[model samples]
Target: MSDMANNDLEKYAKALDNAIMKYHGLKMEEVNDTMRHLWNKTYQGTDIDGIKIRSDVEGGASKRSYNYRVVMTKDQVEMDMRGRCSAGQKMLASIIIRLALSDSFGQNCGILALDEPTNALDVENIDALAESLVDIINERKNHSNFQLIIITHDENFLRKLGQAEVMEYYWRVSRDSRQKSVIERQRFR
Candidate 1:
């Protein structure tokens, strides 16, 4: 009876591992595809060719954890992005990963909200983010429930994003004299 139980437990573990591997493959494909699309549009002349997600298993057979790292391919050489990339690059990668995760798992929700997405991004990267967002918007325009909500204090970034979306007006929220929140619709210049 003990041997039978051990065999069953091993089978269960193998099944669970296989399932995890399958999910990991799907996630990797989604992330890579998203990066390919966004990176090309964001970085025009940069030597960074693309990025790949590397996963490693840690701990013993009974207890395992997966560690993922973003590796950049430049000049046909691969480099890990941890502690080696600039702040803007890291921010861009973070945004891309979020976008990929949303794309893979949030299809039913149909909404993506970004708060202070331009933080740590340079002027050029800000514009690139706007363009990438516009591309995403266009891709999801056919979905009736898809909506994007962006909250930021940077009016310049908002203007750039509005231009990308071809919007004429945006809602501005501010505190009134009595310290109450007021929402107003303002035309984008």
Candidate 2:
């Protein structure tokens, strides 16, 4: 990877970590340690033959690469390898990388947006993601320097989070020949 790409990755990782730590009232180091463990458990010893994470840069920019190895003992008698892409693994990596970057910079980022982040995630993975997000928000609240805009259709998840944190709820409804959206903002008194 080029220096610029590496730098960008580093920055992203630090930002993500800082956001999580600030929102969740947890240490940055602790979040990183948990991420590492989660990564391993999510993919290790699975039926995964091979895994690759590649980023395509626009305008002739250098690409970035990440690799993962998986081994199955009971399924095979010998070594097996294949190239595949796992969305779950990629999502986790992206979150970890961004967190790490945020943690290092200590700079305030304007907004953090997550679009359907929990999509396609299994129950266990979804729980992990929720925990991570809660931690991030808690950390931000503690530091008073973070803002988040999360878009999702998961009502259950939203309700769970809303109970613990102040949130702005928006609902879009369509009526006869008209479409309108309502926003309800809440804050701790």
Models 1 onward score TM values of: 0.83, 0.49
| C-alpha lDDT of residue 62 in model 2 | 32
User: Model 1, 124: alpha-carbon shift in Å?
Assistant: 2.3
Among all candidates shown, the one with the greatest TM-score: 1
lDDT of 1: 0.82
Question: Candidate 1: which pairs clash?
Answer: none
TM-score of 2: 0.49
Per-residue lDDT of candidate 1, residues 1-189 (tens digit): 999999999999999988987998888788788877777787543857877677888986568788989998888898998887777787788888788778877889888888888888888888888888888888888888898888898778888877774566789999999999999999876
Mark the regions of model 2 whose C-alpha exceeds 4 Å error after superposition.
1-85, 165-177, 186-189
